[model samples]
Target chain A: MIVAFLCQNCAQGAANTAGVQRMRYSDEIHIVRVPCAGRAGAREILHAFNNGAEAVAVIGCCFGACHFSDANLITLRRVKIVKKFLVEMGYSTDCVTMYTSRAAEGDTIVGDFEDILERKYDPETPPCPGGAK
Target chain B: MVRLSVVQLRGCERCAWDLLTLAKNSSVEFVSHPLIDGGSGSDNDADFVVITGYARKSDEARLRELLSRGKKLILYGTCPYTGGIFGLMNQKGADVVPVTEYLSPVASVLGCAPSPDELLSVIEGQSAQRQPLCSECERHFTDEEFDKIIRVPDWSNREKCFNNLGLACSGVLSARCAQRCIDFDTPCRGCVGMVDDPPGRMIGYFGSLAVNLQVDTVATDCATDRLGDRPDEITRSLVDVVGTFFRFHLASHFKFPGRNPSTGDELADIMVARPIEEAPQIAATIYGRYGISVALNLIEAYEAAAGIQVSDETRELRSELRAAQDGLLTALDQHDIEALEGVIDKIRTIGGNEVLSNVYFGGFKRPVKSAKNGFDTYCVGPLEIKAVHARSEDGCSRVSFSTDEQGVIREWSCELRSA
Candidate 1:
């Protein structure tokens, strides 16, 4: 399953519009609401994986558009660091990412949800050990 | 009197040597200690027990039994506190079990080797609260230096904080020590256990930097540094995060194997065996593996098991620091004094001034001494050499000799007899 944490100001608004327009994203992806995408942080995101989530999405406001003053930038940097760790460990770096959305961009958030759900972890690669504890 | 018994399960006996000063303490009665000649038997019956070394899977049953004995258990040295250098092997799924998984220590002493004073203070019921070493650090640095992270700057003694100078100091993650390394102008390698939530803190710290670091930055920062890719090159130094941040806590910090380029190789050994160039750093942090040491590259391991194949100067001397291991191993193991000095000469020719004794002798523990006149006594178990000095009645002639236990000197000590 995929766990997506959506920021209330932007990404959540996009997700709500996607729902209003009846846009279909993967049923496996569950969205959690947060004040800012940075609040999802590495620990909370890793916690989702420990509980059987295959991938995690931290959908925040566009870089300069954060309601909480550069909160999305913090999330972006953390996701990059996490990806570096993942690739170094032989796991798929594509398993997690930070995406930015605008209130009117319903299709973009739904597309991100679908793209993340498609990046299945390969058993042939350094296995994830079923996500970090 | 506090009846104390000490057992060294699996560590460098440096910490045991650290306790030698306590031998003369009147209030503490040492029931058993390896260095204290009369010590023998398990340390089970003492009123207080001090155990050093990281416990192995085989040692778990014995450790639990000691814990069941109901005596106060004090963890002495960083090995028992956070698995020491061996803790790095846990990334390979090695069975380095932390005693905390089974029992909590009554009191804990921290340091790669705790000083005699710190150990004494803890033993006397002055348990220090756990705090990050940063709170006590007085050095200062600006955030701009992270752009060019240097290792051991010439000005490290400038009376500022190590991290403030972009020295890659892990003092922030570590618990406090005597600051011995810092005193000598060396960076704190973080041999002590980490403060709470070290990994989370590391993630935050590294994230905040947004450092666009690459291998060349090390050389760019300091061009005249050692040329060869010696194992102790930039990779082994504090320039990298694993050696800096997770130096002692990788076992508890990460939940994965250390394979990079994903060889998927599995051996009964705790560390994966690889050729010199592809050697693994402690974790997936790099391509290869080092054995039971923080810096023992696969070079010596391959040389010892197979014929000495480091004949290629290009490959062998890449990390010039390792230029002496196999030679020293052969000379010391066979008691060849000339060959040993020969290796020392080679290191000196490479401009290594002073006796460079950094080579890790694989399974052999290096001899260490702190006690006065302990030269021969302390080395007994590791490299048994006895030294004798003699002088003539006229004080005109003198001779000194050293050999393994079986050697005896008689005529060498005889006076010239007016001949």
Candidate 2:
């Protein structure tokens, strides 16, 4: 299943907006709210993948717009680190993605989810094991 | 009361002063016999040992004797942690000793001469954590003020960041030196020591920051001197970005030319003689730790230095193919036959016949049929392809090719579409 980490202030608001707008997105996506995307460490993202997330996405505030002042930059760095780790571990680098969204862009969140679903459903790729302890 | 003894193996005794100051201010008793009489500290019966500077062959015996005493070891300077500036003697065949060669220290305070406060903190049984220079100066300026200064600052504005003034501050990668030099309206020279992550993470952070601030060219130009003579224009450009990134910590982190496996002089000669070949390897070893971005940047830098050039035609073709791929993705998402056909025509013009065949075979799960006239295309899901132009030398030829919805090519003919 696709797992998404949404920043509470920005990304989570967009996720809520998408739900309110009744935007159609894949049911395979599971959203996890975080205090800020910066709070999501590399280890935590890797842990989600290790625990059976077929794909992972981190949604945070746009550049230069982080509520915590440069915290999103930390999140961006963490995402890059996790993506590198995933590649080294023989996983598809496309398995993880980071996106920036404003609270008003519900359509963008749904579109990003759709993109994740498309990547996850590649027929050539085998399913990743889920429920990793 | 903890009994502490300070040992100066070789080189300058700068950090010894900090240790002494720490002893005078704290409860730790200093064993002063070694300093007064040139005697070894083994006779002092100290509870803790603080060793500074690079140990030479002659100092090794004394170091071994000190290690044998089994006192808790704390290497208190950059010399012990990374062999320091004197460690450069390793290039000239001098035997320099790093503390790692003998015993593992309980804690290491890594600085040219660590701050007095850091030494005191370690002596007080506290962890001496390194802070980036930015964190130290945050109290003096707010986030908005800092961002404004970094993003857009007056060139003559001396009280703000020195980096904006075209100075090689290295404040981002260095430990907080209390902004002493900056307070005097002078730039920091990074004498304090590198941040905990050193060149890798520090490079990425600062490189991105420089890019954001649009001062990358100036920042890079300032860092080029550290790269030595072998650096080409590409290497010069990146030296500021990556060379500056790992300047202080290069010796400590990666195995370089003048290091143990190879002598510094020998490595220096090789780099000077065969820079294009050897420089990439050195750059790779240094930037590889940071991640793919730095590695890719190094590759581009090396390619540029080596005079490897990609033709504009090829570059244009690559971008066209990329755009076509994006178009194909959009077409698939929207199930638009017209959009798909437009992308197919663009791909055909760009000689993307192989890519089209692969996309059809892999993406659409179709058995593509190729012929002299045209490609018999197949469709899955919603849209259906009637025909696609294959490679042709003479020009457009009318050819009929068809495929069923099940991705089975019914009739095939390979032909080019006329302009």
Model 1 lDDT tens row, B53-158: 6766688777888788888888887677666556655544555656665678888888665666776777777876557676766565556525444533443155
Best by TM-score: 1
How does model 2 score on DockQ?
0.03
lDDT of 2 by residue, B1-419 (tens): 77777777665454653354444454777775333335454545777787776765566667777778777888877778766544443433345556667778888877654665776678677877766775655223322212211211232343445454333356666666422333323233354565444434443443233322311011112111010112222222232221233333433432222322332332231122121211322322222111112222322333333334443433334345555545655654454546755665564454223112122110122222321222222221222212221211212122222223322222323232322
Which ranges of candidate 1 are over 4 A from the true structure? A1-5, A20-34, A40-57, A122-124, A131-133, B34-40, B129-132, B135-138, B143-145, B148-167, B184-186, B211-240, B259-419
The residue pairs in collision within model 2 are: B258-B264, B373-B414, B373-B415, B374-B413, B374-B414, B374-B415
The Cα error of candidate 1 at residue B134, in Å, is: 3.5
What are the per-model C-alpha RMSD values against the true structure?
Answer: 15.1, 26.7
By DockQ, the best candidate is: 1
Candidate with best lDDT: 1
CA shift of B404, model 1, Å: 40
- Worst 10-residue lDDT window for candidate 2 chain B reads B218-227
